[model samples]
Target: MNHQKSSVEQQYVLFKLDNEFYGIDILQVETIEKVMDITRVPHALPYVQGVINLRGEVVPVINLRKRFNLPEVALDEESRIMIISIEDMIVGLLVDSSSEVIQLEDADVDEAPELGEQKDNEYIKGIGKNEDRIIILLDLKKILGITDTNEL
Candidate 1:
């Protein structure tokens, strides 16, 4: 008898920032929320928009556009906050929009390429190819500057 190994697929939450597409492992995502009141924290990182009371727990919110040094745009109806859990900490990511969940086989992802820039590849985990679109898979831990979740 011959048996073939089944391929495991990973689920990702896809979102848009500027014109580029980005994906994060679905397991890390807690919930997607509409843009709401964010209380600004003084002396916090510029990318950190502030904190919000999420279901009684305070969570820090980071603006992905500002985090990536991209051009800032006004928030509209499509703006959303993706609450994700990283180890012991829960944080919110401000995104332009989150559309769908996609499944990709391990083979569909390619390691992020060296772009010969200072920090261009710092936060990228890999490049995920789906149909004609190339989704930049983000390393949330790195993007959030989270060295130790316990520190949060």
Candidate 2:
């Protein structure tokens, strides 16, 4: 089998958060939209910015900047929400901007290296570096509290 074709089949939708580019499995993505009015949920986690009404469906939006503990970047014309599903939860991740989907071979993906003492490390699955940029693959299950990591 051709390596590139296999990678393309895996499919990923890439987006920018802070200064980094990250890729989430396209299978998990439901839709993408421009920044919408989000209603704040009292007592929610800081990263959990709030919720938005999507054609009658209430979806929680997460500020990737806050989730990663990075400096907040004010939303502007380029901001977007990438709606993704993890197990049973539908999450909207706010990204600085959306990038094009690039096909990369399995060989291009590698297990994420330990960053040491950073809480954000728990969310990263592996690092995929291409010719010009690195795509930080996310472990959505672990990141969204779907899987228990206390044992690890």
Candidate 3:
């Protein structure tokens, strides 16, 4: 039997929420675009802004701010939607803005802090520190409820 360590690769698309930086796996992301009109849906979750016609397909958009219980901010030109596919479901995450993608070595990622029994902590994968900022890496599987791993 041969015992050896295998290298792990991680690619992240970093974006801003509030004043903090966060990232999600690049493989999960489809595309990013500026904020667009989302039709209001009746009896929908507060975090869910509504659905949009993305190339003749109806895609639901989630307000990252409302989901995280952050203060509301007016939608502006700088706002963007990160369209991602989780288990074949196309979801759009509304973010404050967009940023560059980064390749992170495994060593660069650290465990997320336990913030005293906060419910949302489960969605965070870990914390990544680089240069002058700390990026909160998200657990896409958990956040998106992607049970079929093969689909991704």
Best by TM-score: 1
Which residues of candidate 3, in runs, are more than 4 Å off? Answer: 1-7, 145-152
For residue 7, give model 2's deviation from the true position in Å. 6.9
**lDDT per residue (tens digit) for residues 8-110 in model 3:** 7688999998989999999999999887889989998888899999999999998888888899999888899999988778999999998899877777888
- The order of the candidates by lDDT, greatest first, is 1, 3, 2
lDDT of 2 by residue, 9-107 (tens): 466889988778999888899899999999999999989999999889999998988877889878998999999987778889988999777776788
Provide the lowest-lDDT 10-residue window in model 3. Answer: 142-151
Residue 7: error of model 1 in Å? 2.9
- TM for every model, in the order presented, reads 0.92, 0.87, 0.88
Which segments of model 2 are wrong by more than 4 Å?
1-9, 118-120, 148-152
Clashing pairs in 3: none
Q: Write the per-residue lDDT of candidate 1 for residues 1-152, one digit (tens) a residue.
A: 56476667999999999978999999999999999999999999999999999989999999999999999999999999999998888999999999899998888899999999948898999999999999999999899886764677
Best-to-worst TM-score order: 1, 3, 2
Residue 20 lDDT, candidate 1, scale 0-100: 86
Question: What is the Cα-based TM-score of model 3?
Answer: 0.88
